[model samples]
Target chain A: MSYLKEKILKDGVVLDGNVLKVDSFLNHQIDPVVLKEISNEFIEYFKDKEITKVMTIEASGIAPAILVASHLNIPMLFAKKTEPSTLSNEDQFSTNVHSYTKNKTSRVLVSKQYLTPDDKVLIIDDFLANGEAALGLIDLVEQAKAEVVGVGICVEKSFQPGRAKIEDKGVDIFSICRIASLENNKITFVEDEH
Target chain B: MSYLKEKILKDGVVLDGNVLKVDSFLNHQIDPVVLKEISNEFIEYFKDKEITKVMTIEASGIAPAILVASHLNIPMLFAKKTEPSTLSNEDQFSTNVHSYTKNKTSRVLVSKQYLTPDDKVLIIDDFLANGEAALGLIDLVEQAKAEVVGVGICVEKSFQPGRAKIEDKGVDIFSICRIASLENNKITFVEDEH
Candidate 1:
């Protein structure tokens, strides 16, 4: 976790409007070494949960989520940012998510066939901002009558209300790196209180 | 390869319009075991190519591509389907690609910093249909002045012209499972040719 914190400080850019652009080695262009270590850390944190599957939203979250799933030897599912409905998508679970960064509302979808009532899913994502994406994923999983074991985040913007929002649902949440403040174009971290 | 072909026949659904829906394990909901096998097979085939980095498009391609990158201990870069030009996306390598299945066109973008002139890249993707996505990735890589070693695909619809289109560019392409036909509600496959 300290290494991830250091990595964020080193490669993460504190842009205007409080955006930590660590896309260099975290999201867009991924470093496998970092991802491997991140997965192991998450596994150690959530190992005893008896997680049946790992899930995340599309695009950015897939890289780390898949690595964690592979290490746990479980299946990984992603809710698509629902495209132009071209298939038999009638039996899907979907919820609207308002992107905090992008300033848009879009539907996140997962087939009911994938998330069953018996699954204990571990939700993962690249970043936790306003908790919109995580809440949307939890909605989809619960719609299938499945259980969300917990939520694992690569980076959490603690200044935002995302952590509080998810904890209100009574789900255990763990983040590898937590940015206490991105105020005045400076990245500051707070110790993660397990 | 044989296991992959068997998985296609067993779990893959043959939808209307030559659409082979392998969502049970390949994409959407993924089986990490299958992904591990696919990555190993691709690595074995392209081991001598001196691949410096593994690249793919976002969402579906990230799972398999990241696994390959982890096994090879290198970096993985993905071309984004591009949001509404939010950040400093002015300096990017982008090209438009028409989705063969979706019946639409979208621009794929990669940051100029990731794909460098010194890179010997290997492309990994989930499916190859009309070769639009693969070609778009190749276009992005070449725009950054990087060398493309080969293309690795999880499934290829041989009935389509994807393979031929990529081969026309003189790129070595390998697919784990080659479906010779997906007509009349049947999933038929042909032997892989090296």
Candidate 2:
């Protein structure tokens, strides 16, 4: 987590005193080496949970989810933002998520065949700001009758209500990098709280 | 490659005599073990190319591209389908791509910081049918003046014109599993070709 924290301090960009842009190595452009280490960190944090599948949302979270899934030797399922024409119209779980960035609401869905009641799911994502996407993923998992063991995030905005929302759901959330605030073009880390 | 070929034979679903769905292990739901093997196969095929970076589009391609980048010890850049507000509006390369599935054309963009003229990129993607996405990615690479050593695909429909289009640009294309035809729910692979 320290490595991730340091990487955030070094490469992460703070914009409008709130948004943290890690496009250089975390989101848009990925550093697979750092990503491997991040996934290993997640595995270390949740190794005892007996995770059956690692889940994430499409686009940004897929890369880290792949690393976590690969290291854990588990399958990864990403909830699609758009329903692909190829997917059958049978037995699917879905929920609507509002994106503050895109300023729109989109339905995220996963086929029931991928998730089952017998599976223990670990939800992973790139960023947890307002936690809408994470909540949507949790909804999909619940609809499939699977239990969510925990939520693993690469970066969390502590100033936002995302953490409180997920915590209110009584699900344990783990983030590698926790930001206290982004002010005056500077990033502050959430210290003494790992 | 044989493992992937066998996986396609075993789990791939042929639909509408044209669409081949390997969502069970490749796209929607990812098998990390198979993905690791597939990335290794790509590495073996392009080991001599001195790839500096691995590139792909968002959503599906990020998983395989991560494995390839990790195995090769390089960076991975995914062209974003929509430009995130967090990304700086400076020094970016953009291209328009038509998605057959979504039935729309969207602009894909990548920051210029990720790709450079000296970088040799290996483009990776989940499927190559019409090659529109691949061509768009190649355009992004070209805009940055980067060299595309090769394009790696998980599943290629040789029955389609994707291969010929990419080959016309004189870049090498490698596919783990090549489907000759998908007719009547039967998947036919291109034989005696690796």
Candidate 3:
């Protein structure tokens, strides 16, 4: 988490008043070395839990999910934003998510064959702002009758209510980097106990 | 490669004499152990290349690209299918790609900050059918004036024109599993050299 914080301070761009852009390493362009460290950090945090699979959404979350899956030696399932023709029509679970960034509500889906009652899922994502995407993934996991062990997020905006909303549902959450504020164009971190 | 072939025969679903679905291991619900094997196979294929970065498009391709990048201990950059609000407004290298599955065309963009002239990229993907996505990624790499060392595909449909179209661009391509034909719900592989 320290390495990720350092990278963000060095290369992360602060836009507007609330957005923290880390396309240089975290999202668009990925640093596999740093990702590996991030992956280990997630594993370390969830080491006590029984995680059968690591689940995430498409695009930004895939790289980190894959690395953490590789690190923990667990299978990863990403809910696709665009449904491919190869997907089976009969056996599938779907949900609609609103993205403030894209300014559109799109349906995200995963095959019912992937998630099952036997699995213990760990939901992971790159950013936790409004927690809409994470909530959607949690819905899919619940539909499969699988217990979500916990949620691991790379970055969380403490100014937002995503953490409280997810926690209100009784799902434990772990965020590697928590942003306390982005005031005066300066990035601030939340206390570790938060 | 043998492991991949076996996985296809065992779990792959043949559809309409044109599609082979390996969603169980390659996409959708991914098997990390199998992905690791697939990643190792790609490493073997491009053993002699000096790959500075591994690149792919979002959604399905990100999983394999990260695996390969981690295998080589390099960075991985995934092209965004849709520009989120978090991304910069700076000029990006964009290319249009037509998806046969969705029967649509979409723009794939890579932040110029991630790629540069000095980078040597290895493009990887889950399925190479018509080569539209691969070509778009190659275009992005070239737009940055970078060298595309080669392309690595997990599953290639040899009956399609994808292989010919990409090879025509004069870039080396390696596919771990090549399907020669899919007829009557049967899957056959193009003779494996390995």
Candidate 4:
């Protein structure tokens, strides 16, 4: 985690208290160098686990997931944000995800062909806030009867409830950069608890 | 391109006559191995060009753009699909794009700060169909007074008008797979002339 903890994305955007924005490395532009390191960090953190598949949501998460999955030599699954395909709901594993940033809720779908009861899933995402997207991914994993090995996140707002919510589900999390606060346009990282 | 012309995605999904679907490498799930090859192909084709940024539309193109950008050690910019941010339309280069797959037209926006007049951008994407997405991306690059070095596409339906459209804009294109026909659920690759 310290490897990424030392990194500053978008030169670390300065936003007022309680509003965190790290838009430079993702959403708008992604630095492959940082993302490459993020993938390696996730691989290093979750290397010991028997990760069968690396799962993530579409748009932002797909980039990191691809690097990690490729390095691990595992298939990367990204839940589609598009309208469910012609395949009935039974043929797909889906869940409702509410985005705190955009303030909207959309149904995310993953084909049953990809996720199954045999997968030891490692969920990855660009950022974690309120745990909405992560939870939706876990829901889809659960619906497939797959085992959730743990979740790998690039940036986590430790001040938020996302960590607790995922832990409540008995899933583990390894976040590279843990933000303790973003008040007064200053960035602070949570000291490693370990 | 012959190197990739031999690769078949999703075992070449069979659907009778003209309708082509490649949901395996991208959109739903992205095979890192294939994407890695695609990135190398792009690097090989455009290696001589001085590319400042690798640009692509969000949701699907982000994965390839990330890989290509990282391999080249350049920044990757993905146009956001979300509603334009508070950055007045004047400050953002916005365009209306119609997705034949989704059958809907929505605006895609790119911040003005990232794209600049001095940029030599290499546009990348997962597929090329009617060329609406490609054309929209080209428009955004042009709006910023940036030079479009070329377009790198993973899969292109050569039978479609996308190739003709992009070529008409005077932008070079390098597609790994050029499909000649998909009649009778059988896949055919366009024979290389050179």
Candidate 5:
């Protein structure tokens, strides 16, 4: 996590409206070397858990989730934001996710065949700001009668309501980098490692 | 390539509209073990090439690209289909891509900081039908002044104009599985070993 935090400090730009842009490496353009290390870190963190599937929401979270799943040698499923014509209507689970950045609520869905009662799912994402996406995945998992072992995130805004909302549902949250606050165009990290 | 062709014959479902859906192992739901094999296949194919980075488009392409990048111990960068809020205007190369499935054209962008002229990029994607997405990626790579070594595709529709179009541009294409045609709701492979 120190490596990630250091990388964030070195390249992450703090813009107006509390937006910490790590696009240089993390989300937009990925550094697969650093990304593999991050994936290994997640695998080491969840080494003991029985993870059946790694579930992530699309567009941004795919890279980290894929690496994590490959590192752990588990299958990873991404919930599609835009419904493809190839998808079948009979075997799908749908939920609503509100994006504060886009100021729109969109319905996200996953194929029901991917998730089942036998699954011990680990939900992963790039950022957990309001926890809306995480909640949506959890809903889909439950709909398939699967267990959400934990939620793994690359970055979490600790000052936001995301952590509290997820914790309220009795889910264990593990984040690589936690932001304490953003003040005066400067980014601050949470002091506690946990 | 044989493994992939065999996988398609065994697990791939031929849909109504010449669509072969491998969602069970490739895109929506990934089989990590199969993906590992795919990573090895890419490594074998591009073994002698000087690949500086593995570039891919977002969503489905991320998994195979990450797998190949990890196998090669190189960094991977994927193009963003939507404009991420964290990205800065100072560090991005953008291009237009038309989606056959969506019936719309959109601009895909990658942070310019991650790529450079010295980099030899291997473009990776899940499918290569009409070659629109692959061409979009090639455009972005060229815009960054980077050399595209070649393209790696999971599945290619040989009956379509994709391979010829990409090859006419002088870019070598390597497809794991090439389908000759899909007729009578049956999948027919042209040069597939399986």
Candidate 6:
């Protein structure tokens, strides 16, 4: 986690309106070494959760989610934002998610064949700003009668209401780097818990 | 590579009109073990290429690309289909890509900060059906004046014109599993060279 904090400070850029762009190493352009460390931290945090599958939403979430799933030796399922024409089958579990960046609501879908009542899912993403995508993933898991073990995020804007929204569902949230504020192109980190 | 061949034969479902759905292991619900092996194979194939970066598109390609980048100890960059509002800056390399699945063409963008003329890129993707995404990625790399050493594909639909399109660029191509034909729900693989 300290490594991520240092990398964030070194490579992350804070834009106006609390947007922390870690595209240089985390999101758009990724450093596999840093990403592996982040995935290991997520595994260490949730080692006792007995997670069966790592769930995430595309496209930013897939990288970290895949790494976490690889380290956990579990399968990873990514919910698709676009309704793929090939997945025309009606046997999918889906929910509507509102994207603050895009400012629109779209239905995210996952095949029921992957998630079931016997599965314990860990939801992972790159950023936890509004938590709508995580909520939508939780909705998909619930529809399949699967248990959500927890939500793992790479970066969380603590000043935002995303944590409160996800906590309302009673799911434990763990983020590698928590931002207290991103005001005036300055990043303020919250006190580390681990 | 035989593992992928067997996996595709066992879990991949051939849908109507030559669409091979490997949602059970490749695209939707991913098998980390198989994916890791595929990444290793990519490393073995391009061991002499001195690949400085691994480039892929969003969603499916990120999983394999991240793994390949990790093994190669390099950075991975994914082209975004939608121009993120956060990245509204004009300092990006963009190109149009036609998605056969979505039946639409969209611009894929990569930040100019990632790729440069000194870098050597290895393009990775899940499938090489029509090769539009690969070509789009190649275009992005070329826009940055970077060298595309080769392209690594998990599964190549050899019956399609994707290979011809990519080969026309005079770049090397390596596919883990090549499908000679997918007619009448039967997967006939091309003879392996390695």
lDDT of 1: 0.88
lDDT of 5 by residue, A1-194 (tens): 47888899888888888888887678866776668767877888888899989999997788889888877778999999888787867778999999988899999999888899999999999999999999999999999999999999999988889989999999988998899987787888998865
- lDDT-superior candidate, 1 or 3: 1
Query: Local distance difference test, per candidate?
Result: 0.88, 0.89, 0.87, 0.82, 0.86, 0.90
Q: Write the per-residue lDDT of candidate 1 for residues A80-147, one digit (tens) a residue.
A: 98552434568788899998677799987888788998999999998998999999999998899999
RMSD of each: 1.4, 1.3, 1.5, 2.2, 1.7, 1.3
Q: Mind giving the per-residue lDDT tens digits that candidate 3 earns over A154-182?
A: 98998998999999999999998899999
| Residue-wise C-alpha lDDT for candidate 4, range B62-167, written one tens digit per residue | 8788888988889999888785333456768899899776789989998888899999999999889899998999999999999999999988888889999999
- In angstroms, the error of model 6 at B1 is 6.3
TM-score of chain A of each: 0.96, 0.96, 0.96, 0.92, 0.97, 0.96
Candidate 6 per-residue lDDT, tens place, B85-194, comes to: 66875879999999887789998999999999999999999999999999999999999999999999999999888989989999899999999999989999998642
**Model 5 / residue B113 / CA error / Å:** 2.3
Decreasing lDDT order of the candidates: 6, 2, 1, 3, 5, 4
Off by over 4 Å in 5: B88-91, B192-194
Per-candidate DockQ vs. reference: 0.76, 0.86, 0.80, 0.68, 0.78, 0.85
For model 6, state the Cα shift of residue A76 in Å.
0.3
For the second chain, the TM-scores of the candidates in order are 0.96, 0.96, 0.95, 0.91, 0.95, 0.97
What TM-score would you give candidate 3 relative to the actual structure? 0.96
Per-prediction fnat: 0.86, 0.96, 0.96, 0.79, 0.93, 0.93
| Candidate 5 positional error at A37, Å | 2.5
Off by over 4 Å in 6: A192-194, B192-194
Worst 10 residues of 1 chain B by lDDT: B82-91
What ranking emerges by DockQ with the best candidate at the front? 2, 6, 3, 5, 1, 4
Q: Which candidate number has the best DockQ?
A: 2
